[model samples]
Target: MHEMTIVAGVLEIAHRQAAGAGATRINRVVLEVGRLAGVEADALRFCFDVARSGLSAIAELEIRDVPGRGLCPACGASRDVDELAALCEACGNVLDISGGRELRVLSLNVD
Candidate 1:
């Protein structure tokens, strides 16, 4: 699955960062995943558990969920959205997405 690829990349980065900092191990990794990012958290967690090795073998994965938000341009109303093509409840018009398209590693705890 694509989550394997994503976990590989994340572990690569984590390993590089840990080595660069002369750390013996990676304690934890914090990822920010948005509702509209199209990533499955459970899949990612499973992939991470399978893919991690060496410095990150016992690293804990923490995922932060970000909520999708949108604003109705026509009615100046804001609301929570689940998809990119969400319709505004007030004016029945397409909403301009404001947030929740993020997929990035926020931080890493290393020793």
Candidate 2:
């Protein structure tokens, strides 16, 4: 799965950051994953468990779920959305996605 690639990148960043800060181990990693990012959190966690070694072998992962948001141009309103091509509930027009496409590391606890 692509989640393995994502996990590999995350771990690489974690290792680099920890080493840059003169830390030998990573204690925790916090990630903010948006609903519209199209990546499964469970798969990421599983991949992390399988791929992590060395400095991050015992690191804990914390994933924060972010809800998708959209703006309706026809209605001039913003609302929560579940998918990318969601229709506006108020005016039946297509919504322009405003948020919830993020997949990034928010923080890392290292020492």
Candidate 3:
């Protein structure tokens, strides 16, 4: 799965940071998972454990979910979305994506 590669990338970054701080262990990793990022939280967690097992920073994972913000193309109104994708409910028009496409580590904790 692509999640393996994605987790590997995260661990690589963690390793760099750990080396910079001379840390022997990682305690936590805070992740932001946006609704439009197309990354499954469960799958990411599974991959993260495997990826971090042999690494220096085998940190605990914390995911913060971010909801998609859809702006109406016709009226320019912004609202929270609960449906399949970015869509405007007020004007019945396809939405222009305003936010919520991010998948990244928000912060790292090391010891």
Per-prediction RMSD in angstroms?
A: 1.1, 0.9, 1.9
What C-alpha lDDT do the candidate models reach, one value each?
Answer: 0.93, 0.93, 0.79
lDDT of 2 by residue, 2-104 (tens): 9999999999999999999999899999999999999999999999999889999899999999999999989888988999999988899999998899999
Candidate 1 vs candidate 3: the lDDT winner is: 1
Candidate 3's C-alpha runs over 4 A off are: 54-57, 82-85
Tell me the spans in candidate 2 whose CA falls farther than 4 Å from its real position: none
TM-score, one value per model: 0.93, 0.95, 0.86
Report the error of model 1 at residue 50, Å.
0.2
- Judged by whole-model lDDT over C-alpha atoms, candidate 3 comes out at 0.79
Comparing 1 and 2 on lDDT, the stronger one: 2
Which residue window of length 10 is worst by lDDT in model 1?
1-10
Error of 1 at 97 (Å): 1.6
Evaluate model 1: give its TM-score: 0.93
lDDT of 3 by residue, 22-105 (tens): 888878888888887888889999998777854343578899999978888799888977544666767788887777787787
Look at candidate 2 and give me any clashing residue pairs.
none
